[model samples]
Target chain A: MLNYFLFLVISFVMFAIGAYGLLSKRNMIRMLLSAEVMFNSALLTLLVLAATADPIRGGVVALIAIGVSATEIGVMISVGILFFKVRGEIDVYKLSKSREQKSRRLKT
Target chain B: MIDIIVFAILGTLAIAFSLLVVEHRSLVYGAISLGFLGIVNAALFALIGFTFIALFHLAVYVGAGVVFILFSVTMFREIPTVEIRVKRIALVIVTLIAISLAAIFWPYSNISVVAQSISYRELSKVFTEDYWFPFLVTTIALVTTLIEGITLARREAR
Candidate 1:
């Protein structure tokens, strides 16, 4: 019981930090890193839940989550690289501003 | 006794490294800290009886994810400095919300150790019998990602 509680607390704290990074950071890669951290907290939650109730199902689900996260990281890194190459920067705000500019140009 | 002790220690390590990953000035340093986070997370997974998951995490996250992040960061001429102002307050509010939610969903005294550890054979049985769809989906996803990543890089090169 205590171990389960401890695990949940750890996952929560990590999730919190990840959320902070995602919300606060301007860089695309840094935001992506935060997403990874959040993914990890999710993984931890799954594992702990499994350890408590159903191990087999939890293990399989966790495996799928891990694969999905890996794929996500790969795609996001490619996007970040492409963004940097084209814009010479990878700030999220700048990306949005560029989109807004394009939309304004289109409207004109 | 041992589980609690180990969990406390590793959990602290995981949280600290994750904080560093988010707070570090240098992108390369942040990515490296993320690698340590992965390693510690894998250990935490292992401590809870998921050896395969731990190994997979170390392989995919620590090995591949960290390397990819580092490589992407190195492409920049200067390390990006993140300036976060208002979000720190948002972070505290978010933390409180998360804790309250966890408390609401708290499964108190409901868990018992069914087994200290699970063997690979049991996991294989589950994979083959019940959860084959997810396995297939993951396989497809990984293969598609490999092709897509390669093509993206190749396109940029050309």
Candidate 2:
């Protein structure tokens, strides 16, 4: 019980930190990484629960989740590559504001 | 007992490396650390005996995904660009506080901890046997994602 509780606490703390990283990081790669952090933390939570369960299914589900996430990571990495190809930098601030300015100007 | 110790150590390593991935300036190092983190997670899945998921996790993540990240990171080689970095001190402090608060509250609210329920067997069976529609959907999703991945990578080759 104590171990399980500790797992949850750690996982949630990781998730929150990841969330902040995702939200606040100006670099696109960092944002992608923050998302990964949030994901692994959740995966840990699932495994802990599965471990404690009467009939353990946690590992199986986690496996599938990891597969899906890996695919997502592939996409994110590609997106980063393409962005770097065009922009020369992976800063979200420069990317978003430039796009936003274009749209705002076009609208006006 | 063995599982608990392994989980604790692996979990700590995972958390620390993930933080490094988030903080590392070089995209190459971030991607490399991310791959290691993914590998650790896949191992954790294996220890728990989900062979199918672990295999795919290794195949798709550590195999193809990491390669792709490294490929993209290398594209920066020809471009003389200094990476635009993250520098939000206030955001970091706020995030630290939020994480601390969440860590305090999360353990108490977990359903399994509250119910002392061991539903792992049930969920596994439910996933494999009678309730398999979701798995089928996941299969289709994986196929489509693969197709999309290939398409996304293919530049107009004349």
Candidate 3:
């Protein structure tokens, strides 16, 4: 009982903090960090599940998840570069996507 | 006894660094914080006995991946220095709601449905047999990723 509860604490706390980071951070690089936290949180939980199950397949699946995370990091970094190139900064506030909102208000 | 203690420490570090990465306004620092978190996470995985996964996580996440983020971060000439003020009431209300939901779904304590009903050995046999092909596919996928990553770097340079 205690063991399961421990796993529970690890999973929930890690995931929630990650989610909070994702939601609250205004910088793109911070967003990326939050995203990785979210990914790690999921990985930890999945590993605990695999441990509890003690199945060989669980380990394999865990490997799959690891591979997925690796690929995701690869893609995310490239996207981050492109974002830097176009916007020249990571501040969420400075993104030109909101330029239309500002211009509309100005016109009105 | 020691395992639990270690797990607790690593978990705390992971959560703290995660928060740091999220809250830090400097992009470079955020990226560095993520790198630290990744290394800790890899250690946690190994401690849990997921050796292969942990090894790969370290190599791919900490070694190769976060470095990529740091490099991408450097591509920017100007760091965003503007601060956006968040409304207090909205922040408090949302935080309260999130806390309430989390309380209800509290893992271990109330996630009683996570019945420890299955055996790990059975699942391992099944995976090794049926999932071999999928494993190969992932290897291929990584190779493709390397190709794509190099091409993207080149294209962006141009």
Per-residue lDDT of model 3, residues A1-108, tens digit only: 225456556656666666666665566666667778778877777776666665356667767777766777777676667666665556666675678787999999
Q: Which DockQ value does candidate 3 get?
A: 0.39
TM-score of 3: 0.75
Per-residue lDDT tens digits of candidate 2, residues B1-158? 66778778877877777777876767688778888887887776665554455666778767876777666666664322343444466467747776676656565564433223335566567678854675676677677767766775675423
TM for candidate 2 is 0.72
Question: Compared with the true structure, what per-residue lDDT tens digits does model 3 show for residues B63-126?
Answer: 8778877877767664555445543543565467556755764553533223233344655566
lDDT by residue (tens digit), candidate 1, B21-139: 88888888888988899999999888877888899889977898788878878887664554658686867877796889588657563555433477679888888888888889888
The global C-alpha lDDT for each of the candidates, from Candidate 1 onward, is: 0.82, 0.67, 0.68
lDDT of 1 at B100: 90
Q: What DockQ does candidate 2 score?
A: 0.38
Error of 3 at B125 (Å): 7.0
> What are the per-model numbers of colliding residue pairs?
0, 6, 5
Q: Give the TM-score of candidate 1.
A: 0.92
Model 1 error, position B31 (Å): 0.9
TM-score of chain B of 3: 0.67
Error of 1 at B79 (Å): 4.4
> What are the interface RMSDs of all the models?
2.3, 4.9, 4.3
- TM-score of chain B taken alone, every candidate: 0.83, 0.58, 0.67
Ranking by DockQ: 1, 3, 2
